[model samples]
Target: MEALNQPLQVELGPLRERMGIGDLLRYERLAGIPLRRRFFVALTGVLLLAIAMLVALVWLDRTGILAQAPVLGIFAVGYAVLAAVGFVWYAIDLTRRARLALFAWVNGWAYADSLEGTRRPGSAFARTLRSRERGVVASDDERLPFELGRNFSIGTRDWGATVQRPFAFVELPLPVKVPHIVLKNRRRSIIPTLGLGRGGARMELEGEFAKHFLLLVPEGYQQDALYIFTPDLMARVIDLGAGAEIELVEDRLYVYLPGGTRFDRPATMEATLRLAEEFQRRFAARTELYRDDQAGDLAARAGVAIGLRGQRLAGSGVSLMAVAATAGVLLLSAGVTAFSLFGGDLLRAWGAG
Candidate 1:
């Protein structure tokens, strides 16, 4: 029993050590501090402004110089503006830093590489496997191995909120052939596209066909290929009468055709349309409505606007109240000075009469 336990213990020790190392590396790589730092910095700015305002109010009260209403009013407005600017600046800085932090985390080892950069494999089947490996390649229950190459294209359009900028459009193009594709409306705002490569042959488009055609190329494929396309605006691509040839290996998908084939068949067109619809649905369900970076930007902008507006309003209200107080103090001071200089003489004359 003792001998058997010793072997088990030895095996467990190495495994534990490897796990610890991996855990440590992960923490180091993904740990973030930007958000916390920004919060503290913004807080500090507010505190400092508050302190300065308190000191100024106290000094003016004690010196009996609060009688100057006009001068005090100007100072109050200046302070309000200054505080508003500071708050806005802090919010923008915080948002920018937060975005950087998010980018680091998403692109870290925890997430797989972007599909856009994956290379296709030399053999048809191998290309598929490479694509799977490059993306978060998986199905419902099991992790899918790299298989045939696939292409993904994403696009977006923004309807302007204000009148100045009415609309925005963006487009992204993909080079590899994709089978199973996903399309998502990152903002739940626009639709995206996914395209498959024409077989192993490359073709150029001409005339009216050229306007709707997109060039699909096979390059830099190793093992298997997966293509990911993210677009910024509305764009569509037609198959251009080309069909993609793919081979499956080791439960992976690969593109066998060196170049995509041209397909002018009715069947191919129907298949392509079906494939596109499937991808669109898959992506719509899976894609997140808002990305971390975009969320941060929106939050930051809102926070800054709110903070600045609130600060300005508060400061203005306080200054106005102070002005009224100062005005009362000045009137009291003048009355007291006049009484001291003339009251006794006036009382003596009234008594004699």
Candidate 2:
């Protein structure tokens, strides 16, 4: 019995290591309904309701009561109710899924950021990977560096403009067989479809945003072809030599590379690790340079600082007011339609003009 139990215990260890609290929550929420399934369910419900309404309209016409004022009024009210219900249901369902996706994306990015503070120097996790080549910086009162990268060009604009200087740089040597690569941020901020040009060849990367740092990898790189350094999770690109095209998908701060051939030997890991280390060192240097440049720019602009906080607050208030006004209009329109159909009959029956 002891011998048999030993093997079972060993098997369970790996399973337990793979399980996490976040995984459980995600499983619970996505248990039965997939994104595509939810969309289909809502679409089918609306189509069925439309068909039923059409059938009812046809029946009313055949009965020669389609033009009867009171009857038409009732039909209009019923139609309005159906429309409202459908709209509400669709909106609720869409909002729920969008919220879920956004939540997951943000949580993942936060996790990566937290890891940044905990990373040990000379450890894999502590070092920046080649893909992240960039970092986001922000101030307490105003200005965010990430927004500048979003536009990918320098110009003066609202929301507090600031220039970024590269503090460090990291470079990865590509395998002759690997045609495309991706870079990802743990925050999933980098767009995947945007290809980075290197040596006149466009290298594609997929981004993945997680809690500590952004991850980048060659798009469509095989699962088995990549590995992280021990105790660090600093990702590496394993060279498979040949066969299959690489693809990238970028989300948040991480990139996913898939559709690559497998690595068969320890030698592959060694070669990849070497490249990963070099890339990491370069990236750290680049970040330092960027921070230094930004600090200087901030000091210069300190004199020009005006009441930006107040402006932001006022803009937010105006936006809220507009949203409230729109909602009020929609509600008023719906209420008027309802009253016109239902109250019209009540007034006529009471002999009111």
Candidate 3:
């Protein structure tokens, strides 16, 4: 709490020197962070040089070096453009990561350039073909162990578009595993892209709370969700997290914000901290003693366990609206085609131009 009161401190002078490609690679290797294709970049540079040399040799060996001048020039120009783009991309990525890493260092928080295969329990963490978390800031404080990062994932066919979707998230660890509960903010279009699909039962809260949030909980676990999301907590969520989507699965609570939430800004980071703290404090007590009676003897053995059904939302990740939209597109196209063919035939039969 004291740290949050203090201004966000970042020392970039020393970090600037280490932003070089070699230094960044060393840092990544030592930190056990994913390389993000650093080695591939180096390999590509060498391969490009080799290809250029080969092209030069072959062209020089031919009798009409002058005749091939245009072709060689084109190759060289393309090669230069490609190399320049790669270099620029590499520099930007490394600089972004280094600054975030420095921010973590000054504040005594853990940082990762890239994180994958987390296998965290949440609708957000469901099966993904390509998934990664970058620029991650994590706190080891047992009082409110949490992680803030930008996550990108490409879901499967049932999961919607294979296009990678990016979102910023703050995840807090819960004391016990609980049923899946999701709060979809009614205000954001990105919330629907979470691919929560039509899973679970849509729960409507009393009063104006229903206007801001659409709650989803496992079919029979409505009581559990209501218990956790009491009136007071719901109010806090509406006030602090009206723009973010909230999901609780197993033993983790994830607050998903828009992808553009910039951790690089002090205000943004502070706001995220406050949001995480509030949610953690409120949720911890409500979930600490929670045990699934449906777990039977397993609850006794594991101390805290959720039943298989409640462990995950039964609905597939595909949303009904997405299905409806796709169907509508197909129907529209079919209708257009039918009208074009039949309308033209009708005109011909009536001898109308």
Candidate 4:
């Protein structure tokens, strides 16, 4: 915790310095094989495009067409320029990722440019498919472990559209498994689409907390949630979490920020670290000794266990408003089609008569 208070060493000056071929290779290795392959693929495409452009220019010059149509030459040059620009942009992004990884290493944190196939216990992790995390910074401290990252979940919506939505999350693993509880940020309108839908019992807290968050827990776990989310804890969560959505599932607490926060920014990283530290400290204390009394026999056993029903929220994957909107759109489309077909025919008949 003392290390977190010290000035964060996030200067970009060293990263901005010109990198040698050896430096590039080192960074590529640090970035991992997946990202390295991506860089090579992009480089190959750029090289091939440049070669093709050169060949075309040579052919045009030999045919004397360059003299006849200067505009054609200009267009070819433009295409090559655009391809070069794209290549440069991709290269810069790769370098930025490498720098971020290095920074994490220097600060004793684990870094991953791509979190494809990596598994973590969370409610959002369970439902989402084709999960991918980028620019993840994980604390190496076993005492205060947490991960701050941006992830996008790929899944088909009810309308059969394949959608990929991005979100920023802070994942903190707890000591004991607790009943699933989701504290949905009411201010951010996007959480419903990305979150575990809406069927679980909506828990409205007393006072101003209700306006800030709509707490959701499994049918019988309302009291359990209340037990964990004491007034002081709720106040701390509201103050630190801001508009971020919170969910306690399995043995982890996930705080998700809407619209995906950037991990590249220094200020953002510091703030995220602070939030994670405080959240882990406060929430973990509340839940560390929590043994779901509803677990009965399991509670009677040596280890802690949540009740079967309390283990997961019985919520629909789609929100009520989303369902209503889809239905409305379908009905409106049907009405329009019916009017266009039958009403047009009736108008024509009347006109003829």
Which residue pairs come into collision in candidate 4? none
TM-score, each model?
0.23, 0.21, 0.70, 0.75
Give per-model CA RMSD. Answer: 26.2, 20.1, 6.3, 5.4
* lDDT tens digits, residue span 159-230, model 1: 111111111111111122222221212222111112223232223334443343333333222111122222
lDDT, residue 328, candidate 2: 90
Please report how far candidate 4 places residue 1 from its true position, in Å: 13
Off by over 4 Å in 2: 1-31, 34-37, 109-353
The weakest ten consecutive residues by lDDT in model 3 span: 7-16
Model 4 segments beyond 4 Å from truth?
A: 1-25, 47-89, 156-164, 193-199, 302-304, 319-353
> Per-residue lDDT for 1-353 in model 2, tens only?
44422311111121112323355345335433355445455566666776777777777778877867557747755885776587666554344333333332432311111012322111111222221211221112111111100111221233111212122211222211221223333232222222222122222223421233322232232221132221133332222211111121111111121212011112432332343344334333322222112223554377422122111111110122334565799999999999888987988878964
CA error at residue 201 for candidate 4, angstroms: 1.4
For candidate 3, lDDT tens digit of each residue in 21-40?
Answer: 67666666756655546655
Q: Is candidate 1 or candidate 4 better by lDDT?
A: 4
Give me the displacement of residue 77 in model 1, in angstroms. 5.9
Q: In candidate 4, what residue range of length 10 has the lowest lDDT sum?
A: 155-164
